[model samples]
Target chain A: MNGIHDMGGMHGFGPIVREADEPVFHHEWEGKALALARIALAGGLFNLDEFRHVMERMPPVQYLSISYYERWLEGAIALLAEKGVISADEFTARLTALAEAGS
Target chain B: MTADAHGDADVALRVRALESLLLEKGLVESPAIDEIIDLFENRLGPQNGARVVARAWSDPEFKARLLANATDAIVEMGYEAVQGEDMVVVENTPRVHNLVVCTLCSCFPWATLGLPPVWYKSAPYRSRAASDPRGVLLEFGTAVADEAEVRVWDSNAELRYMVLPERPAGTDAMGEDELLALVTRDSMIGVTRALAP
Candidate 1:
């Protein structure tokens, strides 16, 4: 797929910013997102190609806007839903429920 | 929470929700998640790659093997794992510098280098690294010699690359452990040279 994620050789994105003393993960959720995606792939929920394809399917604007791990999370969710491991409605309900409980 | 904080919180909530659903459905266990996290955090990372680079610097035969067949050579060093199964170690010489990137996506050598940094996966780095590697290297404070050729290797799903950085001068007396200290992750990625010892 010729998605924005295939960003090689494109122009105008600007100079690379190197963060000093950068940690392995910027947020706790980022690590969990990575672990979940790895587990999802490892458990045969989806293959590596399928996992990357789902992320490539993301809308260009949203794909560019989200952080690296956020894309991982989005891909994991989409793959899980596609694999019948979880439904969209269930995920939404759980998200809403968790948000509500936190508040 | 500020807007950014709220966004972070929302994403955090979404991940938690996903975990809960997976847990409820018996698709995944909590301890398994922790184990994965622990593996990446504690056991896997650039330290592994640094070890490889250090050994290659100290051993002529190992360097020859690593340059000839990186996957088997690295595995011999005990760092074989997923995403790093097919490896190619490009050596940096007096007249040639090698840079690695995944233009399609971030296909890094995870077993050795661990997860990539955010900039490596960002649009700017991905786009420019292939097209203007010398300029990219300049930004990383690595100025290659005027006559040296810059070679960029685009890593893919099936194959990954790591740079065999030239061993620094005045390191003839240094041991492998001391050599490891000079091998930064960026050096293995070919953005910068090994730190001077």
Candidate 2:
């Protein structure tokens, strides 16, 4: 569970950035992602502890690269697959379908 | 699309897929998701926390109860949900200040504070808060006296924290609404002091 996500007191990231009038969620996608996460947890799909554990285990590079709700969505997908709610093949197929439709 | 844009689209797709998948499987209801989002997006926020701080400033009994049993006190105010089940309200006085951070991830009191700010989850804050509390506070434009002790709290799944910032001087007659106006999100998070009227 010890990973780069546990980043208290280590350094070099930079100063905290504050916007003039920040909304609760920066993107519409982020709101949906967060909603999915909350609903998934409420429905007994996965608990907070389990979700937090997997989030900590996310690839360090990805952790720093993605946005906050992006991480939440990724962790939710990983949990859904892990818990057998959705199979790995189905997950990949959906992603591929989405990408294909976009192009 | 750029990689980042593609990534964003990908996440959006996954969220939609997961929601439908759960609904099809009878695991969750669609309205529940809508309600949760509505709560965080509209009904909950630091404004909720500001109300609690304002009450504590005006009522000594409430402040004592809040400091002694934060979860109960906060719940009594009708703010109860995920990530806020167990809370510790640390008081800021002349000699001590408190800062809350979740080193492992963003563990926040979402029921009261709504979602955390982007910076609260940034690598910069996670890595530097505890090591340079004074410096971090300074960046937030809060310069604590050299003699005051800075206490950093690490929030987790089991317990979360919010700072009970010092009541600023010269507002003895202000009502709760006026007091609430002076309470900002940063003060509850301990990055800055509550504003003065």
Candidate 3:
């Protein structure tokens, strides 16, 4: 898939923004997202190629707008639902409940 | 918290939701998640790549093997894992420099180099790395000589790459441990040279 993710050679995005003294992860959630993705692949819910393909299928505008780990989170959730490990309604209800509790 | 903070919270909530659902369904365990996080944070990282680069600098035979067959050579040093199974180590000689990028996505040698930096996966970098490598290097404060040829390696899902940076001069007296300090993550990624001893 020649999505926006295949960004080689086309220009004008901007200069590279290099962070100083960057840590392994910026947010706590980012690490969790990474861990979930790795676990999903290791458990054979999806192969590495399938994982990359799902991320590539993300809507281009949203794909470019979201942060890196957020993409991981999105891909992992999509795979879990697709693999029948979890249902979309179950995920949505849980998300709503969590959001309400926090608010 | 600002608007950006609210946005982050929303994404955080989504991740929490996914995690909880997986746990409830018995698809994953909490302890397992922590173990994965700990592995990447503590056990696997650029320190492993630094060790490989340092050993190559001090031993000519190892360097030859590393350049010839990077996957087996790196595994011999005990740095083999999922994303790094197929490895290719490109050397930077006096006349040629090598830079690595994953044009399709963020395909990196995770077993050795750990997770990539945000800039490495950013659009500007993914786009310009292969096309305008010298210009990209300049932004990283790395200026290759005009006479040297710049070679860009586009890593993909199956294969990954790491740069074998030239050992700095005046380091003949330095041992492997000392050499490790001179080898940095950027050097292995070909964004910059090894630190001068």
Candidate 4:
């Protein structure tokens, strides 16, 4: 089953902002992925009653996504915007193009 | 075979020591062009693990022995668990079913079962496995009785588990060699049951 952490279009977020590409690695648990997986597990295991309750506590997709992906073109731009990598106006314009393409 | 950086002491020692040792020689002078092989004595890789499942699937008497004392029964076949104890091999009878999880960290029978899949180590799997096993199995495309009490095993220092999936229907006459081919890794993990068709 898809774990709560399996995102619809969120893999390969980035290693761009990383200043150091050090050989020695420190393992960090992917929190956003874990959370998404937990929500999906709730979908699989819990009854509707419990599922709704758990969903209330889970984060919205917008917050969990990192930046750009092969999917979620808009969220990627928003991440760049939040970092001041792009202006809000630029973010909207790119997102508008993305929305029109899907149509 | 790549473990995350925060792996336990065993992984750290084995991986780091071997890599550095290889580099100390001229074999990998750059250390960047890595081509190191990891080996172990009596490695009970998947082939051995599959044999255990195949034997259990075909022999009722062996299954009984496996259930009564899994570690001892397994040792007779030459696969010995190093870190697990109180091993319980749960038979997947048609009337009842079984699955496994580590509510704590991934406490697995590394000797007999080999490495755990990525999903097995995640928090969602660990948390929901015991309480909502049926739905989890269903999501993974395994059959279950809504009426069947979905037994979820929580592995510990005391109790480690291996799911003996119900030998799937329509393969009674199939020989051991043929049957082993049908036993997917997921079948052993309890996400699905073994089948020949």
lDDT of 2 by residue, A1-103 (tens): 4588878767788888877668987777787778878877877889988988777787777777877887788888888888888887887777677667778
Between candidates 1 and 4, the one scoring higher on lDDT is 1
lDDT of 1 by residue, B100-176 (tens): 99887788998899888878887889999989999999999999999999999998888989999999999999999
For residue B1, give model 3's deviation from the true position in Å. Answer: 25
Fnat for each model: 0.77, 0.74, 0.76, 0.00
In candidate 2, which residue ranges exceed 4 Å CA deviation?
A98-103, B1-6
First chain TM-score, candidate 2: 0.90
The local distance difference test score of model 4 is: 0.53
DockQ for every model, please: 0.62, 0.61, 0.60, 0.02
Candidate 2 or 1, higher lDDT: 1
Top candidate, metric DockQ: 1
Q: Scoring model 4 with DockQ, what do you get?
A: 0.02
Name the better of 2 and 3 by TM-score.
Answer: 3
Evaluated at residue B121, the lDDT of candidate 3 is: 90
Q: Return the top candidate by TM-score.
A: 1
In order, the Cα lDDT scores of the candidates are: 0.88, 0.83, 0.86, 0.53
Candidate 1 lDDT:
0.88
User: Chain A only: TM-score of every candidate?
Assistant: 0.95, 0.90, 0.93, 0.24
What's the best-to-worst order under DockQ?
1, 2, 3, 4
Comparing 1 and 3 by DockQ, which wins? 1
